[model samples]
Structures are given as structure tokens and as C-alpha cells.
Target: MNTLALRLFAIWLVVFGSVGISLASEFFSEAEKTIIQSFGPWPPPLIADPSNSVSQNSEAISLGKKLFSERRLSLGRDLACSDCHAPDQFFTDGTALNSAHGRATRNTPGLLNLRWSSWFGWGGAADSLWAQSIRPLLSKEEMKFTGKKLRELFSEDIALTQKVQELFEISVVDQSDEALFVIVGKLLAAYEETLISGLSEFDRFNVALSASDNIGIESYLATAKRGLKIFIGKGRCNLCHFGPTFTNGEFGDIGVTQFITKGRIDKGRYQGIKALQSSPFNLLGEYNDDQQGTSRVRTEHVTLQHRNWGEFKIPSLRNAVKTAPYMHNGSIETLAGVVEFYSNLDEERLHIRGEKILRTLNLTPQEKKDLVAFLRTL
Candidate 1:
């Protein structure tokens, strides 16, 4: 090993000698320690959603949780949001494309840590969590419920009707379909915001580093420690997948194919921008509860571009072990498959105007294993 590497090892020895533990995970430089510290202190602060009126209200969240699995909300009285976003499966239906309903165009992303996300969906079609909640309800391919259907369902469902009246302070029958739609969306968003993942083994390791608790560090998986170095070091995974929630909450084109069907290509953020600008529920629209006007800044200024055609949201990696198959359309079946794709990335799949950030990693076999071991701790 070189001087720095030897020093990194020596520091580990000195730190752990008193604790009487000798583990491969103990190696670290001051620089590496700083980078590792950036991962977290897990479970980031919950910011209030200015666009959703009932953002953190407990009553709304309770009702929304009930509504999440309420099958009657669908037109056919069959599908519910939970049907695709199964609660047991990290709130993600472990499928590439959810065919539980009609046929979804993209993978069902996990609901963990959504309160920290600035944008929602793979294509980022909505600006607020409430707006995104409204999507599956209205889509014919998902919950398959229209505003009119919701009005009818709420009218006859005595228990839900009573809950809506108590929380909203308005009878469901008195409200327009549009008003009811917004109300339900806000309620759901209030509940979805609570779906945060607990701290993982990686978080514990980060904490140990912060306290210089060498024995605590030794408890962390040795291979995972090496992998964590690769993630924040030469692999540069931290550039996109950094911070407490493990994502930057932005879109990117990482050479993943955008073809949804043979002829019907998923235009990703290109079409998402069009839909977002036109959506009546967007943060730029009248339904936004934020009176301060600052909450809509991102939605107000986003410009459409050709490069956005294939770009998709960079999802948080907190619950990666629970959410699969991976990628935008769920093309990759396993986490290792995702790693392999990046290891020998096919850059030709990317368009000329696409992001230049990605290149073939060409990771060694052992490197791939180490990297995957780190990801598991996430």
C-alpha cells in the first residue's frame, strides 16, 4: 500500500487498538471520513409541503392511509393504489411494469422518503406530492377513478363520507368533482409523507466514523466498508446518490433505454414537462396551497429540451434492497444486474444531447461484489 493507504491503515490500528478490535472496515483517511460523514445522520428532516393544505395533519393522514387500500375508489371497484404499491413490499409492487391494472409504462418506485423529494414519478410529471397522488387515481391504467367516480364513491361510503366531512369541514356531496379530487390527493399526500425507511447498517457505520468509535466501525461488514469507499471514491456514485435520502431529487439520462413499447416510446421528461405544464393540479396552478409564491419556483421556470426526452428521475437508494426490479421501466431484475449495467455501460444507447456524466465503469469482478455489498447496507 502507498503512504496514504498505509496511514489510513495505521490510523485505524491506533484508533481500534484500545478497543481490541482488528477489522478491515477500520481503514479510513480524514478526507474519506469527511466524505463518508456526508451520507447522513439518517431520516432527514420532514419539510412541510406548502402546496398541500393538509400536509402534516394527523386526521388527514389517518384517513389517507385507509383510502390508500380502499378498492371502491376505482371505477371497477377492484384496483386500489396499494394494489400496485403493495405496502408489504416497501410500498412498491415488485414488478418491472405493473400489469395489475391496465398496463403501466414505468416501474413502480418505492414510497420511502417521498417527503424529501422535490419532484415525483420517474418522469417528474408532477411538482407536488399531492399532485402526484392525484395521478394514479385519475389514470385509466391504474386506480381508474375519475373525479365523478370519486364523488359518487364518497357520497355512498358512509364511513369515508363522515371522515371527509369532519376533516375537510365540507360535505362531499356539496363539492365539485375537481374540489373532491384535490381534497383526496392532499389527504393521500399527507399519509405518503410518513413512509420513510429506518436507518440501515450503512447509517450505523457512518455514525461510528463520526464518533471515532472504532469497535462500532468494526461491527460493520468489511466488504461493505470497502464498497462504501468505492461509492464515495473512484466510483463517484455519491455525485448523484448522495445525502441523507441518497438522491439529489433531479432527473438524468443514464443510458437506460426509454422504449416502453415497440412503437410507443416513453419520452421521459420531454413529455413529462408537457403534461406538468398542462396539468391543472401542478404547483403553478390554482390548487396549490402555498400563498407565499416561492414553492412554485421550480415548476414555473423549467424549460423543455431535447435532452430531457430520455431523462428519468434519480430515485432514492434508501430502500434499494426492498424495491425491484430496477430502473425506469423495471428492465433490470436484480440489484446486481443494475451494478453490472453500470460496470460495462453501453453509452451508445444515449442520444447525442444526453448527459455526459456517465461512462463505462469497467469494474473488476471483486469490485462489483464489494459495490453490491455496500448497496445492501443502504
Candidate 2:
């Protein structure tokens, strides 16, 4: 072959080889996508089922909603669930930190689409809603009432006691301490399971996008779409906060606030799991008959790994704008603040192994605004 022809032939061979490799790479990427799509949905739906058996009854729901707002449930007769999770504020009252008789160690997460969660609390302490409701009742900073004193209140208040008794078919006994605690927990759980939240604008927008009605969605509303791109793509939020509920329903060290408050290192999930193990009010306790045997099995057999330290339950993003002071410790105060935290997360402070990838994204100003705007739509 001529020298010029030989050079062209070599160039063609290299180009063809590169193109073949590129085609294989593309095929592998698509295959990965096909495997994921085979699971029926990309972001799996939340507990959107209206016929949730645990909270299907109208009477139970009504009582639960009323009780949710009642402050008298606390020992000080002041801090009800509504004190933190008010209905008007998408169930959260927008506190940087929760306080009642005393300040709480963590933020008050909103109660939106909770019917779908298999676990509750920042540590995944409770396996069911009924079981989850009992935590605040026993906490000194929350309700602060012992099971015995709570029963006394039930006994003294005839109407209150009667309502509870009729609802659960159990009498409030002054002497039987165990029975009183059990009944109180059960009644409250029945109430919480009913505190479901309304659908957000994000859900509708997602539905629109799913149906290929992209033009019908607004450009300003496109901020949320861009945020969604960042979240599931370069933002890397989907590593932990995945699925339609915007949570993997697992634990992680998301670089929240542990060192920010001097001397108040709330050991995150490490101590939380230990506390759950010892807690009598927990689902494995004698009070947890309603969760079937599922609660007992989980509590008794559960094991905690070392990495669980500083790991907290991933809260749903359905009402992200409503619940301020994000994280288990309620350290960050606003949605914008939260975006900023993740954007500029100090890698030196993160406490997990092999966590080199959580470097500061150095998000642009517009990216930050667009991200916050999107979170608000949720």
C-alpha cells in the first residue's frame, strides 16, 4: 500500500475500534437501566394505599386527629404532637429545635404519608405506627408522664377515660400499672396511624411528566424538575434518599449537626439502637400486641453495626418545606439551609468509613436556589 493509504488505513482501524468500544459501553449502560426498570417503577411509590388496614376505620382516624392536637397528653399539659406537628404548617410548626416542658434532642419530623413507613423515629426504633406513638409519651422532655400517672389522669377524667375505654374496649385501671400503659400506648398508636398528610404539588407534577405532558408543566415549576435531575443525578442524594418517599428507609451518616452544639453529641443511631434495645415502651415490649409478632421478632433479633453511629432515619421529602431544622438533632433550620449543608458538607467532620466521595460540590448560586425551590414544591 502507498504510505498515505497505509496511514489512512491505520487511522480507520483505530476509529473503528473506538466506535466498537463506545457501542459496548452504551449497551451496558442501557442494560443497567433495563434491569432497574424491570422492578416495575423507578422511584417506588410510597404507602399511597387508601385501604391501609391498621388505620382504615373512620372513628379511629377522627379520634386520632383530635388526640394528635391535644396538648393535655403531656405531663405538663402543654406539649401535644400538634405542638410540633401543626396541621397548618404541613404538620410541622417550623421550629429549629423542638421544645415542650424541655428542649428535645432532635427535630420534630412532619407526619406526611407515614402510613407507608415500615419503621419510625430517627433510629428506626418502632416497627409500627402504634408502637412509634408511644415514644414521646415516656420521654422526659416530651409527655414526661409515667405509665402510672397517665392512667390516673385517664381515671380522673371520666369523659377522657370513657372515650379511650370505648375506643379500645379496655378500662383504665388505677392499680394495674401494666394494663394502663398498654392501653394508653395502643390508643395513641391508633390515633397516629390516622394522621396521614395530603398530597403535594410534586406528586401531580411527577404524574404529569410520567404521562408525557411535559409542556403543561410550568418553567418556573421547572426548578423542581432541575432539582430532581440534580438529586437523582450529579447531586448524589439518591444514594440514601431514594424511592418515591424520597428515602431508602435505612441509616446513614449524612453529615448533619453533631459537633455544632458543644457537649451535646447525640451519638446518632449508635446510642439510639442501644436505647431501643432497653426501652420498655418499644414494640418488642409487653405493650406491642397489635403489631402482630412482627414487632417482637424485629426488636428481639435486631443487630446494630458500628457504622450506624450518627445514622438517623431518612425522613420523607413529601413535606420537606414544612419540617424545618432538619436531621435527627434538628440542627439545620431551613430547606435552603439543608441544601447548603449538603452543598458545602465539611468532609473533615463526616464520621463514616470509605466516605471520600462526599466532597463539597461547590454548587453554583443558581443551582442552590433551584435546588431549594424544588425542595419547597415537595
Candidate 3:
């Protein structure tokens, strides 16, 4: 009932609102801040693989892009790299097993961020990207192309042969079939190195949060934030899915069944190590461009043991929402299924010496929903 009283109330409201906003700025706890900081500044530095001489060469990338889509690289001349790794589907074929040749045992992973990977394939079979590129071409379950077949193709295709000569400085007539095969792999790897994933909503949030700017991160959903808290906290997901690319880039057996049929067992990294060591195309082999042999250290000293029996490479979670049919066997069909698998993890199924990092999460239904929400932002 008085002008002075009304003015005083209005001033108090404004002051209280300002104080509330100030307090809200310190929303994240100290532990949460550290976790957020570790996630990134977005677009991590490109890792260099010295084993491939043309890893970053522009001409090699161009030739590789052309070659990646060339079906003639396969035995049947019907399957190309793009057959399993289609560009429109975020590089994944969205299938459990690649059936371009026959049905591949392992799931076809997306090719994004291969430059940062220390190893390639589900089992980490290849130490170098170039070597990994060559494996599928030679595998019976994949492209099934021999060195002789590839050599013949190169000799016959005048334009492709000329491009190879101009780009790699190798004469098809003079080079051995194996050497030509390796050269093609190197070019394919050069193109794959450029397939980096773009920034996501999570990356933007991390950038703003790292800078201590609360206003800049207003677009981030509250449910997603709660889910992120669960991910870095109780979910223990950060133990494997950490760093800028959201993966440790290592192998683990999280209790997924590895049996292909009745008697056959997919002895993942155990077999991978044997294959990598025996292969002539391995980084430690003569084909490696790195004369210094610095990149061969991982290959030379890699430990093989019974624990690696069912292990598979921990895939990067970037664009994981887009690439479905999760896991090495593609047994988990949805993101929700993946979350449920972790939540109700079967410890008995794991190897006796399997990773000690995993355990039953016992997440509430709401918590599982929140975690999935957070993953979608990636």
C-alpha cells in the first residue's frame, strides 16, 4: 500500500536473483571439473605413424580414396572397402558381420579416428593402419584378393597404373606382387587417416565447462549432465572409455560370448598377436617405411597371455549412437542393450584373468536411461 515499500521489495528481488545466479555458476564439483577437463578441448592432435611413408601425403590420400571404392581389389571384383565401411553410414555397414565375401566373424567397426589408434581390428591384429588395410584384402572371409590378383589388376588398369607410378614412384612391371599389395595398403591408409569425427554436443559442453563459462553451456540438457555424472562416477565407464576420443584404445574381454559355433572359439587378441608377429606386412617387418624402427616397439614388446583369450579392442565412443549393433559379435543390438549388458554384467562368463575393471553396475532403471542420454550427446 505504499510507493516506498514497493520500491524496496523490487530491489530485494533483483539482489537475491543476482546472488542465486552467482551461486549457480559453481554448479560442478571439483571432481566433476577434473573429469570434464580430461574429456577435451575438442579435435585431438593427429598421431603420426612413421611406418607408413605416405601417411599424410595429399596425393596418396587422393589415390587411396579412389582405390577404396575400387571393387577390383576383391577376388570376386564385387566387394570394396566401402562395401563394409560405407561413407553414408558413418563408415560402418550397420551389420553384425560383414558379408561382402562371406560372413566375417567380427563386427565391422567405423573407420573414424584411425590415425589415433595404436592398433587396428577388433582383436588388434595389425600394429599399423597400412598393415591392417592389407589384412582384409587377403583374408578368405573378407575381400579375398591375392597378391597376384592385385598385381594383375594394377598391370591391366592403365590409368590406375599410371597414377600409382606418379604417386608412389613404383613401376608395376618391376615391382613384386607383394610389394604392390603393400603399396596399395599404404595409399588406403593415407585416405583413412583423414576420416576424423566432427565435434559433438558433448565436445561443445566440455569446451565451455573447461573455460568456467556456465552461460555458454546452457544448451546442454540437465538429464544428460546427470548421466555424465553417472558415467564418470558410479558407472565406472571412464575406466575404459576415457580421454579425448573416449577410449583407452586397448583390448578387454567384458564377458561377451566368443564362441562362433559348437567347438570353435574366437581367441581374440591371443590369435591377433600371433598373426601380427608372423605377418610379413607387420610394422616390425621389412615393408615398414620407418627405418629407425621406433614405431615397432609396440609390436616387438607386446605381451601375449591367456588373459587376452577373448579380448577385443575398446572402440571409440565418438558417434557411437549412429553406429549400432554394438560389440565384437554385434550381439548387443541397441545402445539400451549395451547399457543393460554392463548393468547386469555376467561375471561368470568372463575369463579367469579377464580385466578386473568391469563389475555389475546395479544401475537403477533411471540411471541406465540417464547414461544412454549422455552417450547420445557424444
Candidate 4:
């Protein structure tokens, strides 16, 4: 190859440490550029949760932060939300399924950048963040506390009672079990909403792309660029895990087992729809503070289908490096493992009713490593 062609080729070449990377304006297609640009503009537009009146409230955020670590929410008064969602561990306990208070069926999901998400949890079971917050305290396999227990904790505690009164301008003693329960959930969500991830290396590369800074673009590794081509190209990951937050905020069944026990199945989004529709805490319910009812449409129209049986939320790929044991069940241990799973995906293992979006990528070993290198920048 001539100097011009060689230089251009080297821009896409995989390199090791100390070897500088580069990107040419002509490297990616117009479509690829559009897809790459869609990954960010870091820290997406901050929209307050209408369902939770105290979503952005300062007092609510403070109180919620306290409550997140408060063990009193648990029936045993031993487990706290922070125990499973450790701050240093990126709000995940680093376990496949958290067996803290008890054996949790699904993996403990990261709590960062939750404000951007309309639906919550692996199955998108909770239509609102506050409702999702209440789940840990009520789950039989988790903290396993009841509404009455939660009400008692707040009502009986002198300091908590005062805070509750000050925050809501109402005494906790006067509130019913369900009412107090909702208040705590709202407060927890308020604090949780602020837990956003910072700009990753990928975001910086995106900034370079936007500015047409060839030097700035060079900072992104060459192997990653190859992986990026695959990601937005043949891998078709951007189809689902696209846009800001790196997810479509929809569910997919990527051939993961849904079995909870011998013959017992988790019934992912199918049961999630049923739970959301029946729950009083859903966006359409009375507890929602959205007097305008602006956020109720998604919840109102959600219907259960046989296709949803094995479907789980396509989690945000932001900070994918920190949150380990990937998938709803936390079955994949490493980023490489996750890549491997998709690379050799079993179509037969997929739900019969599930969409035929996924197929075995059959990635070569170098392709796998390159993809992982690209993912780490996120």
C-alpha cells in the first residue's frame, strides 16, 4: 500500500500499549457516524419524574440517601439497599444473584442513571422508579418486609418520624401502611436519581468525532474502532442497545435460561406486565403524583403477550465494565463471557414467540477481544 493508503489502513489497525491510535473522517460510513453519535452527548437531558413529586427535591434526596442505607427497612433489620447495591461496586453487589437477606431470583441491577429509564428492573416490572424502589423491601427473597413493618419503622422512630413530618408536612403516625410505604419509595428514588455515571473514554471519543478533531479521535484504541464497526455494523447491537444510555429501554430474550428452580420458571416480562397492571404503584395508579397523567400512556397500553415470557430488559451499557455478572440472572461473569455468549448464541434456546433479532455472531477470538476492548471504553 502507498503512504496515504497505509496511513489510513493503520488508523484501523489493532495496536498495543504506547502505540497511538488515530481515526480518519472517511473511515466510518455516514450511517455508522450517525449511530456512533447517537451513543451520547453525556449526561442526557435531566427530566424530573412526574410520578414522584419529590423526585428532584433536595430534602428528599438527603432523606432517601439515609434510607437507602437504613437497615430498619428490612424485616430482619439486617439488610439495607446499600448492602446489595454497594457504591464502590457501581451499585451492584458483584454477585450473579444477591443472597444477602435471602436468595434473590434476579441479579441486583445497578442504580445509576435510573432517572432516564421509564421502566425499572430486569423485566421492566415497575413502571416507576419509586415502585421499583419498594420491591427490595417487599420481596420474599429479599428484605421481605411488609407495608405494616415499614410504616411502624418510620412512625415509631422519633427522628424518622420528624423527618417524615417535615418532608411531607404530615405525621407518619397518621399515614396508613401503604401510604408510608409509598413515601419511602419516593424518597429512595429521589436520591437514586442523582446517581449518574460520568463520561467514559467512549464519550470523549464521541466528543472528538463531533468536533472533527482527528487527534482527539486518535485517543480511542484501534481495536475498539474495529469493534465499533462491528457493533454498529454486523453485530447489530445498536439495534437494541442504541441511543443515549446504550439501550432502547425495551426487553429482549437473548437465549438466557429463565428457570428459577427444578421445573419452576421466572416468566420474565410476561409476569412483569401482570404485576405492573395489577400494582397500585404503577404510573396509572392513585399514588402517582402526576396530576396531568402524562406518564400513564406507556403503562396503560402495556399488554402481556406469550412472546414476553422469556424477555428481559436490555440493560444500559454505560459503565458496563463495573457492573459484572451480566444478564437478568447474572449468568455471564465477565465482559468477555457476555461477548462469548452472544458470539455463539443458541437460537433454539430462544423463546418460540420471541423476536428473531439475535443470532450467533460466531466471532473469532480477536474479534471477541476487540469488541470487549470497545465495550470497556463505555
* Candidate 1 off by > 4 Å: 1-26, 348-351
Q: What residue runs in model 2 are displaced by over 4 Å at the alpha carbon? A: 1-54, 218-220, 290-292, 295-301, 351-357
lDDT of 3: 0.85
Give me the displacement of residue 107 in model 3, in angstroms. Answer: 0.6
- Comparing 3 with 4 on lDDT, the higher-scoring candidate is 4
Count clashing residue pairs per candidate.
0, 2, 0, 0
The TM-score values for the models, in the order shown, are: 0.92, 0.78, 0.92, 0.92
lDDT of 1 by residue, 55-138 (tens): 889999998898899898888999888988899999988988888876888999988789889888888999988889889888
Q: How many backbone collisions does model 3 have?
A: 0
How would you encode candidate 3's per-residue C-alpha lDDT over 150-181 as one tens digit per residue?
87897689888897888777677898777888
- In model 1, residue pairs whose N, Cα or C atoms come closer than 3 Å (at least 3 residues apart or on different chains), thus clashing, are none
2 or 3, greater by lDDT: 3
Local distance difference test, per candidate? 0.85, 0.65, 0.85, 0.87
